[model samples]
Target: MARVQHAKDVAAERLLSIPGVHTVGIGYKRRGGEVTADLAVIVFVDTKLPRADVPPDRMVPLEIRFFMDSSDREESVPTDVVEQARPVEYTHIPAGTLAGRARPVAGGRSIARAASGGGTLGGWVWDGLNDEVVLLTNNHVLGGAAGTDVFQPWGSTAATDHIADVVRTGTLDATIAAPVNAADVLEEIEGVGPAVFEITTATVGMPVEKSGAKTDHTTGWVEYVGLTGHYGSTNDFQVAPDPGMPNGRFAYYGDSGSLIVERTNPSGGSWKRVVGLLWGGNPELGNAKAHQVQDVFADLNLDTLCAGAFEEFLDNLFAPNFPEEPLKVTPIQLPEPVTMPLTTGPRVSLSGALLALQQAAGRPFARSRPLHRGMARDVEARLRLSRMGSDLVTAIHENRVGLARLVLDRQTRRALASAAAPFVEGVWTADELLGRQVTEEDLARFHRVARIAEDHRPELQPLLERVNRILGELPGRSFDDVLR
Candidate 1:
């Protein structure tokens, strides 16, 4: 359910900026009396029906359905206007206190210390197997090994004040510290409510709170989940910084291990549920990435150690809103999450860009292998007449513009231009089959390919430009109009 909601959130973030889109939600698409899970983007206007021109179509794998909020409906405002209260942003409490209720240690306050140094104590957790309580923080904060001396207020607190011992290390940059006195720690957190035994998975757009050594208590929104950042794969998620808060970054350098929890309504109680363990993030992007608690617990092998307790908790966490009926068709599976890999090469490839565009436009007609071979052959045959076929192929393969331009003289240009007509026609051959679903992905690919061509064959620029304008028309635009 969280996964589905997260997908909807990604779609909403991309679509909300469009002129007409009012709201987005998780819903079902029915075909032949069977329901398929999908994200529905809703737009309502008393005048002309508006279409949401969502960008980066590949962001969410779910099939998006544009819904017009009929003019006849009684309600004027959007249905999803209900907002969750934001968590308190700052704390005046001093550091050195135990996590939770002990002396109100704000999120940014430093608590636990290790051999390398001290780090902010994020939150607390229960050792279901040993029947003991432990302070939850980042593995990097606790020396990433057992028996590290944990200090309160760090070594800077009037000479080292040892408070606990590092017990275990877990995936997702998490560690458990067995406090000398289990009862000394309180369940209550500064600003936020108590940390409940209940755990919740991250949902996109969900309000959440966290405390760290550098920024104290802060609140933010869940921007994404199942995100693969520079941090190696797995179930990691991201939190967008709260613009209203003073904290500059969601998670700072010393803030690793901060525990993020769901925001509770009405201001106070034990309603807050564990959500994520903050490891690191890019502040420039105004987001912090954390490992989802479900994945963290699973990596810790808690299900095997705690047996029934773990399974019961998971059951409650993942229970459906209503009993789900089987669907006629298999639901669309989201692509495996990946942040662009760090490498020194062309960020976008011609064939790669074309492939992404085809999928986005619902026109996965034929494999790019056939198209690549055909295009390469056409270019080859034309350049061979100029006795520069190998040079052109090497230039294209190496992405070298000067070499390509030198080889593509007027005569070769004329031949390539003529050959390009057949290749371009193939792209639209399945337009009827795909319903001409143009998207930003296609526009971007066209622009990128055109820009590369501009660096080589200037004559081909106008041709690709025309192709882009033609495709852009299907989603609501004209040849001369700006993309909507």
Candidate 2:
């Protein structure tokens, strides 16, 4: 038994590495119309299962069979090996144009057909990994890509229906749709009911129930855990074969994406928790399987959203200005608040604007002081750029287009300081005038705000363009040159 179980585990890992093999598991190999205790690794490739009319001994496909020995080595079983191969299967919700919900939509009901507009909505599930509500269904159901519009009650009834946006898409044969309105979602399933609050794992022989678009409600037993299918592998459950149904199958074609939940208590009304996302099954053989929900979420990286939020919370917890170590036990004492004076806008008069421009340039006006004979040439250039900026602002306000253009060009060149700008220590540009730490950030911020203002106020567009042009050029000079 231990060898068989290890063989099962090793075979599953090997098949998973091979492309096109969907799921893997360990089950009794059927021989001469009977299941043998001799365990074999069951693998589902993109092949079809044998129909009921085919005898069990003849049901095994000749193309594939793999086995593991006690030494944990994999060898292809001989073609004469009669072990039955369960072909690839998928949820079978049928294609239809039906509409009009008899009530608010719930899981296991018909939603939109596949993005191909064909399959059924498997179910609705809460995304536990992320703190948001999502309508759970198959990737095939939601158009197999992000941005598919999911319609409630089928896309057939276009008027007076609900819509949700597909947000996540993946190879697990699963997609999650987030609705526009939160209230439209229903927590309770449609039939064979379980109100899903949390997801649980699957165990072999676990009694599970599923409500789907086609079957409505049905009960099944977990036959194999960790089985792979064409798109990906997880677990496979066998729907109880019922003689009354077509081919004795429990679910029909439209049941893809159905939620499989564990029945907590067999004899009483106990809560059923979600165990898997049903995608496909064999009608003739009564074999079916689903991707485990937790596995699906993890594969899709859905939990990363929660991790980002947790990081932000941690940042706030350790913020500075708190009491020092030994005194840390005491409540934090915030520093006294600083008050800043508010100004409406730049000074309106030409003289006042010129003074404002000088202050903004962070340098003395040319006429304010006598320059030393050996002073760097860029100092005089800086003063010239500030004067030109003040002149351009006036020209723009007065609609002197030609003068504004010429002054704007000169000012922009000066801001770049390619020739007239000096490098300041540890600064990209003008480090001596503006501290190294805040130079880049403050200039970038100013550029962004001016660009936005140009978009909203056409009258100020010319002035704003010049402002942004200068800010963009501010990073060209280095700190050493400015100090020299």
Candidate 3:
């Protein structure tokens, strides 16, 4: 027998003294402590259970503790209600375990061969990660062609391959569908899954529907958008339709990859714009949250709508090279939030970030300092190039090291920080510079910057309105979006 340590023993070591529980047995559920000299705490049980040790209470239960400290892995989620904005906590939360959606139509309608008992309802075309765009339909919906092998849910072993990877030119849509020839034969494999395809989200309320091999056609409202979630048992990724329109209608199972939309159902009105792809949902709340079919498309990279600079920057981050500095603008003028690849001379450890703030408050070397290799090529040169920028360089450089403690002297830092607009310390944030925060004057400066910002094109209107709203929401001239 091994010398089993109880949870109590682990806690004692971390505290450097005894913990809440004075004593514990071999197996008991309780707060954890460090064990095996690692950061993780060891789980324990109250009994060894040579046989099934029955509890006096007649109930055998297991204990699992969710670490509360990790906000990223929160056990609690947003409250399901109307009008409340979804809190930006977990960036990528997926909706549910969904396959896609399919419908049956005339034999001539489907991508499947007409002779294979054909009928086709509209399906969705979604992103499949690379150049591939997955076509979702019922296994029965799409008939076999003479050639090309299909992968079943698990593997091809005679279980009838339902999901077929799209190998045609470009993506097949309502206007165009993947064609099937006589040589195609869908092989079946044992122990697989429902035939599936991911549906990429279209516009804000693009209408869509599905006809599964089993259940023909079903409709629902577009809910939730831009979601990121994990598969049930695996870490496979999903980014669901992140936002949705009014009302709470959405997709359900057997409707996996169901084209989410404000579908132009013979019904009328702008409210009918289709959105969302059916992937999964919350069983606990019934139909409260519907996952996006686009998640699958995005996961698979199926949809090929906008793959210009806007698209490439997302997946293949380093695909494009930046020859110049990213644009700088006031928060009001900023287009969308961009994650520019920032390089500091050295790694920004916690202590280092704190140290730089103090140094900024004090004095820094007058000229450039060779901090580390990761510093931008022009960083030191820029410091040498401008006088105030040198000090701003040091302060900004410290902020690069996680410097967040100081009550920002917007005026003082602005004087030193900006290479373009170097002025005196009387002003700080837009609020300060405009003689107050986010005034009409601040909005004017925002427009000046927006006029020059290439990214701000097509974004000026909404951005301007949002800035006003945020300023109106501000309490006593406090600025929090800056912190964000």
Candidate 4:
């Protein structure tokens, strides 16, 4: 992986200088419209051309060979030429009223400098050295030196709309702003819930999602990591929109400073781990570029402030109201079972199990059927269970004894166990049930129970481990040949 990255670094500037090349990075090679396992230096161009029509010097090379000082040998790396238009910074003037202002401003909302156009307010972070929570966004969006005023929802002039003042600026087009009232800022995004305190490095083919000012919430896959672009940042990464999406778009104008996060499914809900900061992209072609979030943190000396396990537990416990009175209701009646004639049929196979597991893990919020009646009640139940499950996992992972003790209280445990009974039992019998394919909702339910058991119930650890092993064997989870 280091060799490939080094080779890309060596070749990026020269490639960018070429007339047709727009960006340079490392990615999987494509052959006859199919992605291959081979690693290649990817060159983005406006259009693919036949060798006959282009000048020899302007054409992209098929392979890049460079001498390695560490190995004392010349290495040859293949190249992949992809057709993609040049990406531009995502900042623009507001044409109409934008709807993204709140008392406590969060990430993924429109914000701009007093004199500049609008851009997204990435998220909130803690400046430990300064002992204050501040807003994280692009330097271009919150331009000028320290003390520049920023407003939310585009061209607002009200004094109340003036939210933050630029505090620090750094490389990767990142900047931090001190909120006028620290209490008026939140550590969450608009559509996505609380941001996870942890941050991770981007890997090729990793599934990612982001909420931006222009596009709202969208999911995508990392096309390349350690990408070198015209922006002069060596840690930039490229993302392409999910093929299943309707418009095939990810970020757009006014979407700068949006936070790109990993799409992960834990017990409580879909938690987002900060991965990168969206700065610019070619929205029409669905090619977006972002800086590695770790770089942003290191450069700015900032840390994320997210909700802890005990806080989440308390919020889940008291936020909702249960029915005040027990109403008389008819019990469900079961029909008499009848033996059926046996016929030749396909038995459950490993492939089927893997498919079910992938669907469950990949799309955490997918539902099998739409609910008409009692929808709100059902949603509340799921959310409560999810929160409790997440709290247990977080406590275990962080080794928070106090939080764990609170989460494992007798009353809380009983409520959680009762709510998770159906899902926990289904995990055991899921393989036994034949004929029908497992639905994402069913697997999501089982996943929640498995997470809770993995953290609290030792007896179920073996089952959970076996399930994880199967998940590890699933294909298409990663696509970086360099990592192999």
Estimate TM-scores for all models: 0.42, 0.49, 0.25, 0.62
Whole-model Cα lDDT per candidate?
Answer: 0.49, 0.51, 0.28, 0.66
Q: Could you give the candidate ranking by TM-score, starting with the highest?
A: 4, 2, 1, 3
Per-residue CA lDDT of model 2 for 112-155, tens digit only, reads: 74344434554444443332446777776665565566666654
Candidate number with the higher lDDT (3 or 4): 4
**Residue 78 in model 1: shift from native, Å?**
24
Residue pairs clashing in model 4 are 268-386
Better of 2 and 4 by lDDT: 4
Give the range where candidate 4 is weakest over 10 consecutive residues by summed lDDT: 363-372
The residue-by-residue lDDT of candidate 4 on 230-312, one tens digit each, is: 35787789988987664678777888889998888443433467899888888687667899999988888776553223333
Candidate 1's TM-score: 0.42
Candidate 1 lDDT, 207-226, residue by residue in tens: 89887766667789886554
TM-score of candidate 2 on Cα atoms, chains taken together: 0.49
Any runs in candidate 2 off by more than 4 Å, and if so which? 1-5, 12-24, 29-40, 43-102, 113-115, 128-130, 157-159, 234-247, 266-269, 301-484
| Ten contiguous residues with the weakest lDDT in model 2 | 365-374
**For residue 264, what is the lDDT in candidate 1?**
76
